[model samples]
Target chain A: MNDGARLAAADRSARVRHADRAARFVADAGQTDWHDAVLWRIRGKRDAAAGRVEGWERLRALASEIKEHTLSRLDEYLAAFEEAATANGAQVHWAADADAHNRIVRDVLRARGVRRVVKSKSMLTEECGLNPYLEARGFEVVDTDLGERIVQLREEPPSHLVAPAIHVRKEEIAALFHEKLGTPADADDPRLLAAAMREDLRARFLAADAAITGVNFAVASTGALVLVTNEGNADLGAHLAPAHIACMGIEKLIPKPEHLGVFLRLLARSATGQPLSVYTSYFCRPPPGRELHIVLVDNGRSRRLAQPDFRAALKCIRCGACLNTCPVYRRSGGHSYGATPSGPIGAILAPGMDMKRYASLPFASSLCGSCSDVCPVKIDIHAQLHRWRQVAAREGYVAWPKRWGMRVAGWIVRSPRRYRLAGRLARAWLRHAPRRLRYGSWNAWGRARELPRVPDRSFGEWYAAERGKK
Target chain B: MKVGLFAPCYIDQFYPQAAVATLELLERLGCDVAYPRGQTCCGQPMANAGCAPAAEAAHRHVAACFEGFDYVVGPSGSCVLHLREHVEGAPDARYYELCQFLVEVLQVERLDAAFACRVGLHASCHGLRGLRLARASERQEPPFDYVAYLLDMVDGVERVPLDRPDECCGFGGMFAIEEEAVSVRMGADRLADHLRQRVEVITGTDMSCLMHLEGLIRRRNLPLRVLHVAEILNGSGEARNG
Candidate 1:
């Protein structure tokens, strides 16, 4: 194979080993602690915000029920949305996969003779590699969200959904701006850094011939696309350009416009603990004479939807609450997942898209169920992670050592006699074993955690002695 | 009531005192308890590791051991939960974590127990979320802690406050070995919360979690110790015998 192919293969292999990547991420103890604190603070803020609402659990149940209802009749809803959108003078296109989605977007841009395009924060685009695809086809695409723009400048995929560059320190951003955007040397002020980004993106927004944004919720009844953002970049990008293209996964549909009240309420508070995002823009039709297009992408979502056990993952609203609440995501960072969506949600979703390449993603969590409790849509995320582990094991993706070790343990544990014998031998060894031997490389449990002290007698023996005395 | 004591394998071998305390505590509560000899493990270690086929035999073994009991009680919430959820076609035996049985079944409103120390209550994840022994910190519900309620009944036992209560101590069965780095880091963070509260003792519903935290405390040589709630409750009370 060629150099590029070899490099890509190596990258894929590296991503498959999540434990190794997480270990490397945590090696910088200070940064891991800071990341943990940042995400945890967000989780705390979310809890405080959620507490103010009287019927928060009821709202979650309602949201979950609505999504379940929509998914059950997704085909009917999609057709209704397409008809409503077409009547509203917006073009509707369907893409079966990432390649089809990218091709459709490219085709639309080419037909309009659009040379430059500006995009707001859209994880779907990242998943589809839209910018790189367009760039290879000779279109200059710029990400307008400040976080996305920073990661764009650094040539890295987003490390977070809500805060794309959260992994990058302010000092690093300042250094990056100093080297690339010619900002003042050692300028670390947030206001100054944001101003620098604003100036750079403003020029691109004006020159761009078309705008692309992600749809947070697509109303089936009215065919209106809703975009929620704190920065209002989605509005600027979509309104400034003559042509607007909104890309969304088919699962982003709500049955009616009124359902927005419940989703919008849960979305912002769960995402960043805000009462509401600054911009909750609705687009039913384009500005007079400006073209509007909606590309509905499937790209493995339909396959995942068909899975009875994992279908609930499709109910996610891209709020990133699960990411904020996940302990594994907080310490390891999103980049470790090597996917667009990271955290507990990513662990469950990524395997459906590519099982072999993403097998290790499921086992990355501690199964604490925090993600499920914090989820706005009430997806059983940790339970899904456990389900995926079962899938991975059944499909022969588990390492042989673990498989065999569990088998041996199972055999011993099934019989009381063997279990007692094993316990006696293990206790004796633990009691008399040399410190060096007990703490050796083979003792993975002892590498970080100390071995528990073994008692001289088992509970069974002690119980027998107590009964004899009685 | 006839009670079967279901001691988890870890507690049976390494921390037998916890099981003994559980047995004595139940006896003090006027229940005839039996330590079924045919019992082994709850098969959680294998089940959680995605080896359910391997775990099936142990599940069957455990179900058979506790079949005839009126109520099966164990000190570990996680193990009890594992049995309830994973033991397929097992007899419909009534099982309870010790706190659940004491509070819900026995309806023990008061205890003649005492412990004169500020102890931090580590709400083990399984006991808190799995068994609903307490309202989780993430929810918007009214606060309630069964473990704290029981501990409150014990004289001279002062419960200390933690910054973030109900966080997992990260002894996730096989997860401790599979993801050792993250497991240890999470445990250390939980330890920091307890240490920050200046508590001399940390007690919880699950000894598995306490075992992990105690391991860390012992390794660091900190002036703190861990105990199962049963050990504390049983250590107190000179009550009349049944």
Candidate 2:
């Protein structure tokens, strides 16, 4: 590994690894959405100038209430959604895990006697591993979203929730396109690559027999689904396909469309600094005789809801704003999440699926609270992440070194004398210490950066000395 | 009033000047300051590393050291934030982050110091986010303006801003070393943004971040200097340091 890789790998097993990963949501997030954030800042400045836009805060409040009310009665709405969806002749399957979710999606495609399917940006599909499962099952799956298609062509995963292929620079994407489609075109100009992808995917979007897309918000009030996309690919995928399959976690349900305004106001503003996204499209009830499937996959969400504290995580709108604002996410990038939906929201949700599987995610924050501040509906992502760390510790999902380290620390903290003794010892240790202390992970941290030198006299000693004179 | 001046270990050693400024600032603000010398670390290194247990001793040492002081104030926000959040018994111990102590407790309106330059406010994540001295994110009503309020008081200072205000510089103690690339990238990004605004100097409460940025600033031979907000507020002006 290169120095950077070796250093990052050294941190892979640290207690703050999750915190480290979450901090960079900004740098790593919206790599594709760079265009999006600039757009939003422009929109934000303009909106600021536009005097008062009525129903903005009220809309977020209403959206928050809708989500709140929906989650409060989640069982009822989910049941209603399943009932309406099944009655409308759409197959509804529940998957407990990503494996199961992927299997169900693959099975749906096979059952329809379809071999090829086109897709838009859906975090659920990425989380469920659906495309690979289908591809592995001898079916072709084409990504319709320009970003998703670029990542698909490159055999990579989407880096951001909204913009899947964010990590690939346009030049690299141009090369990917150059390799995939004999379009020996210059890839550096994003406009050129996007236009090239649009041309190539337009044919696939038309020929694809089925389309699998992620539902942005599923309305229980009318069994209608909403999707907000900058690329407008979801609309195209749903519009052209004979079979439209919407994959969503159980938590996206809100009672009414009126409530979407609240989340919509905050979502685009926080995610991209846009006053609102370019399009917020809703699809309620399929056109007569079309096959529409809504897979209400649990994928550990039900289990998260089973616990009162974590169910709010399901309230996510998938704007990736939290990721964009996170310092950890900005630095580490998304691939380290090891699963889809990497970022602040991803850190909290990943722990639920397998606390150990994604144990390191909770430490992804500097505890900056930017994610919570930026969150449209106001999810306390950092707090939830801390709770996850406690849970992971309780669940025996700690590294041996950290556990022992904490155990030793726990003994010292609650006991004052031991704490003082420890300090004196450390001071003495530092007094004669060489340039470095090459023990454990400190070696790695002390390499690029030197530890702050310990003082000979503790603050308490100075206090005592000065206090005695007084 | 008797105040326990929490000189962060770093301040007590490498950056004694900040501690001295803090001590003088406290005294000028009308309080007898006591240096709690027995205190070494706030145990933040442990708590942040998810080894709060290990921090227990450090916490006990600090708490016991400052047990008698009517209030505790520190020049460093990271340390004071640690005192406020992670430090044992700090919540009830009448603790104040340095700027907070100046603005709220000591309640100093006019300071005997001035620097006539474009000052970029580097809100250390601890002071900016942890003690939440200024940030309210989005839900916060009208946003509590603490840091800006204090900086505005500085004479002839133009508070140059960054594109993403309140974003982290990625100096998460261990993080800078572990994810060195991302950490360095984040620091460089923040530094570049500050430079982009053409601020003559960058200042914040946490010297750790400032020190990291200072290293980068020196490496690039940038004209800008990094100063602790405490030093700036105390009128201890910064000159170019090699």
Candidate 3:
């Protein structure tokens, strides 16, 4: 397929039919409960990790301020970063869109005659559909991160940002390894499965001709690429491969090396509850024989930055803390989001990418505001979700039934007389309606919950009779 | 101080007793409270559904009705939050959720009320997180709960501890029907937590949440009951065994 067709296909697949998909996930009550418990445990661990710090909230605020500062004068920082990176002997490429991004990577690999590539966990690469694009053109792409590889082997998208394959069970992984990598069929132990994955990844890493990694932080002053990983696989891939390419969104820039300390302290704790990742590797310059290429992709981020209502999302450090703490995300699972980065952050970002396609994302939440509280960068995620709903409605993405419902309800609520009449009629219907009709298919609430029993008099009616003279 | 009582549409209709209890509770606390007759709804339903412009008329109506009051207090946190956060050209500053008004506005040091029942306190999301009426579990700040403090002041109110104190009851307006399956599942889990603690009555700052849980309880023929915090604090809960 052409790039446009491919992108259209990806967009189609990513359009979240949230309610329908969430219903499917919640249908299996046992699985939903298990998912909720696992994520809640992660949230608990994050709380403990964050609580141990003397000024964790302060660190989060500082990080948010630094990001806001960097984004405000992004043009100047981008120039500085390009100059510094070039001085450090690394080539930097700018891609205005995803098509340009995918093509740039393809051209780089083609020029180097790279046959096989190993990629660490990069949500940006997933966002650009890089793996599929490269594979279709006959270059073998293997995900090196253990969780990423599990999903790659299963031919599915990574479910969570940090854990990637968090939704999958160990028994399922053991079965997958047995089918694909010759592991013992009964090897459901986590350690054994991890060992098998490590062994399999080792061979692929050694044989790979190129490496692609996602940048955690790009320092403008130092011209460095920072990668935070738990498995140490990204370091291996970037060092062992003959050519290394780092893909990052424009929002990834941090002003100086000193500012990195604040984010580094918060990233792992909020992500996996570790004080720091096992591999916090920084690449300043390419190794002697290998070449380093940095692809700065815009891909709609610049547009988001231009909007004040959404620019706070740019402060995100890609921590999955919001997802772990989100009750909806926990019960619905990541796949229900049908976006690359599925959760509160994704809900805000996806709509800007394609309003018509991802309209359901913004409305998926209950506006519970927990995501905002746990956010390491203090992104007002729930507020953004609320804002995006307005955008969706204005853009004609909201369904007609809801739109008309709101319109009629709005008219009724604006006038006390109309509202009173509507209330009286509703109460009368509730009190006198037939059982089958009252609890029918049209009433979603009545499927599992009974509607409120109507009362004899409204509070307004009671007040007029008893307290009007007083 | 003269207060304007803003009972949400649902509370005004199906759960009028909670509104009555709120009025009585406020009066007993030595405040002059008036029910604004022209008040119907707070425009929250439209605003939260993403039609903010459509809610303008309702917001103006609210401002007009409660214009002269010293404070506009509502029994539902969800509705009050919408007024504070979403309403335009409305009296946002004067709008207060019932617990917030009692704790922060009235400074009620004591209550001459009691209900001998094991009650599960459902921390409605808007009250706990939006209004900052309590310390949300997600934050590592100084712990406080206005609703619980008021509950503690009443005699014989056994506040049963929940495994998950502040998780949402999934009664997000329109969310209840829009994402019915997940909504029901979330509400079910919340009820399960209360049932696990052997809670005889589930009470909260908002009747919307209780209405959702109560719907489930009635459907299943559960022994538990739901009461707004106002009813329990007004000394009416002890008389209602059903």
Candidate 4:
């Protein structure tokens, strides 16, 4: 589906759009609890891993500084990277948007006469709609990562960045495999499922004519691309195929090779609590007779870079720490976001892509600031969410009811006399109105929870009666 | 020092006792506390809902009401945070959440108060993460909670441990209604942690959070009570229970 259609499918109503999708996910309370517990366990593991390192906060500060510096000089760094990569026997392609990005990839494949392709996990490709774009043109693209393959078979967008298909249970995966991949009917064992996926992907890897992977960090000084993964799928895909295409957001650039250590140290630990990713592949130049293609896609990143308040978000290393630590994200499944790179980071990033469609994304959180706290590069995530809310409101994306309600409430709260009168009126309504009327269909707060019991006297009234005596 | 008492809109209407507890507690702590009669609400509700322009007047009102106090103290971290961060007129005003005022400003060493109960502390998001009243679990910083420290000083008060210490109670003002399902689920999960700890009363610096949890507890008819930390610190002999 197109971004507009996908966003529309996820949304039902202005008041309860995101909440409706989340409600469906949490309808199975047992499953919701299990999901919450599992993510919380991951958060706990991250905490333990981070606590083991001395000066972790300082390291985060340094990483933030490095990203900020690179972003400030992004054009200079991009030109340098282009120049260096070209000298290193790599062809660099620039895409102004998603359509441009997809067209560039297709042209590269067409030029090379490539048919079948093996791909690793790349949120950039997912954002650009490359898989469907390639498959539509008879390119026969297959995702080699186990989790990516499961979602690919199900024709679903990944619910997470690091652990795609995290929302899927092992039993469901077994069922999906049984129907799609011809696994045993009773195969629920994790090891067995993984082994089954390995056997299936092994064949595709060998038959592939080209490969596509996402870049973790593009070293501008050295013109090298770095990809980190536990599955080693990127290595298999890029090496086994004659032509390799590495697509990356322009924000992935770091100034020097030395800066890679700071990110490498924090990436896996922040993501999955592994001290380091098992495979950290750096490809500076292709082997003889092998084609290396680097597509640097803008895809709304330049617009994001122009936003002072939100540009810090570009500093994200795609660590799922913000996702794991977010209370709202844990309870509300990532798919409920209905955007690529779901979670706190996505909430901030997606709105910049399409404000009207992804308007509810910013309001998805409680503004708890946990996302900002856990972020390795110190992006003020929750602050950015708040900023986006204001931006949405200014742009008239907020619902009319909320806008009018806030405007009216603002007038009342502005004057103490009007506020006291409103408080008294609210109290009287709560106390004297019939239960049915007070807890009517219009009252969303009263649906699952009781409204607060209205006291006979407000604190203002009590203060006047007792403490205001002269 | 003269302190201006700022009760959040919720506390002013639905939770007056929490404001009362705060007023009494501050006075007892030797603060020359005054509740400015012209005070109403901080612009937090409007601002949090993304209508910062609408909240501008309320921000100006807050600045006018609490203009001259050495510090402006409120019972809620959520409201205090809004005032500190977004009060356009009083950008430099010394607004503080109740706990921060007590722990940082007063340097309060002892409390002549006691609550003979096991209490589960819900670290309200604004107070814990926004106000920095406590160390959030997400941080790699050393463990410290000013609210817990004060609670520890209370005689006969046993603070219970929770599995998720600083998770949000999901009471994000309009979020309680807008995202009702996730909000209720989050509150329910937080309550489960407290119930697991076998605490009689769940307390937090922000009654807004306790208010949300209390709504759920009252609806479910759970065997628990909610109180603001001020009520406990103000001498909990007068505290009401479910």
Sort candidate 3 into its docking category: high
Clashing pairs in 1: none
Better of 2 and 3 by TM-score: 3
| Candidate 3 residue-wise lDDT at A420 | 92
TM-score of 2: 0.83
Estimate how well candidate 3 is docked, as a DockQ score: 0.85
Cα lDDT tens digits, model 3, A348-374, are 988989887799998899889999999
CA shift of A147, model 3, Å: 0.9
Those runs of model 2 whose alpha carbons end farther than 4 Å from true positions after fitting are A1-65, A86-91, A185-192, A391-467, B9-16, B32-41, B55-71, B86-93, B114-119, B135-145, B151-164, B194-201, B214-226, B236-242
Question: Can you give the lDDT of residue A25 in candidate 3?
Answer: 92
- Cα lDDT tens digits for candidate 3, B58-129: 888887888888898989888998888756666566999998999998898999898988999999999888
Q: What is the C-alpha lDDT of each candidate?
A: 0.89, 0.71, 0.90, 0.90
Across A1-470, the per-residue lDDT of candidate 2 in tens digits comes to: 33543444454334435434434544444562463344334334433522244545455555556677777888999888777666666677777777877877777777889887988888888777677567767888898877777777766777778666666666777777788876666646777767777888899888888888888787776778888888788888888888898888888887766767666666776566566678788877788767888888877877777787787787788877676666666555676576578888988887787665687777655666777765656677877876776677667776678778766766664554665687677667756666545334555444333444556665455545655577
Candidate 3's C-alpha runs over 4 A off are: A1-15, B89-92
**Distance from true position, residue A348, model 4, in Å?**
0.9
Selected candidate, larger DockQ, 2 vs 3: 3
- Greater-lDDT candidate between 1 and 4: 4
Of the two candidates 2 and 4, the one with more favorable DockQ, higher being better, is: 4
**How good is model 4 by TM-score?**
0.97
Please write out the lDDT profile of model 4 over residues B29-91, one tens digit for every residue.
Answer: 889999998888888889989999999898888889998889999989989998989886565
| Pick by DockQ: 1 or 2, better one | 1
Ranking by TM-score: 3, 4, 1, 2
